[model samples]
Target: MRNKPGIKLTKEKRAEMISAIKSYYSAEREEEIGDLAAGLLLDFIIEELAPEFYNQGVQDSYNFMEKQLEDLLAIQKQ
Candidate 1:
């Protein structure tokens, strides 16, 4: 199968996520990571992990909308 393109982030948003990743490592793991490392980690996550999350979100929305459609049909006039 063909691979999808990696998710793209705005420069500002990418910087923000890099900072958050650094902070998480510092606070939760007690390890400090530099911007380059953090940025690479973020890239890996966007490429490797984000699709599963995106797919789950799509599935959730589909299920919710399907239920709503069923409810709408139940209320249709005969």
Candidate 2:
């Protein structure tokens, strides 16, 4: 059996991360603040955190992807 890595983060840590990300983008471009914040959080998880939390990577990806698709479809119907 393979040993899983422990990658735990608290809410404070996540908030700190989001703040650093906002600072970086704030220096780089004139992006919309809300979009930048959301994108930063998504990118941080996908790039930094998902591999440790998900033993089965594709399963996590598919689940979120499907939900996003369903949400989009619902919005289209409205």
Candidate 3:
């Protein structure tokens, strides 16, 4: 998958995440995966799922700010 559009993690961070991915599979499923496989899995997940997660995060921020504003308005009225 050359030139696939995706966010790039720093090499160190990427290594750590790849390690985590391997660990997750080992711990959760009792299966050991290779570095290449884990890296590819990570790429697939970031490419496919990151946008939905990002949107959810944006929505969460909006909800939190709206609640905070409501509280501030109530205080201001007092």
Give the per-residue lDDT of model 3 (tens digit) for 1-78. Answer: 456666778999989999999999999999999999999998888888876898899999999999999988887754
In model 1, what are the clashing residue pairs, if there are any? none
Q: Looking at candidate 3, what is the lDDT of residue 19?
A: 99
**lDDT winner:** 1
**lDDT, residue 50, model 1:** 90
At residue 47, candidate 2 shows an lDDT of 57
Off by over 4 Å in 3: 1-6
Give the poorly placed runs of model 1, Cα more than 4 Å off.
1-4
TM-scores for candidates 1 onward, in order? 0.90, 0.38, 0.76
Candidate 3, residue 1: lDDT: 48
- lDDT of candidate model 3 versus the reference: 0.90
The lDDT of model 2 is: 0.67
Better lDDT candidate (1, 2): 1
Per-candidate Cα lDDT values, in order, are 0.92, 0.67, 0.90
Model 2 per-residue lDDT tens digits across residues 1-78: 134554456768766767766676677875546645655575667556777667577788999999999988887754
Please report the TM-score between candidate 2 and the true structure.
0.38
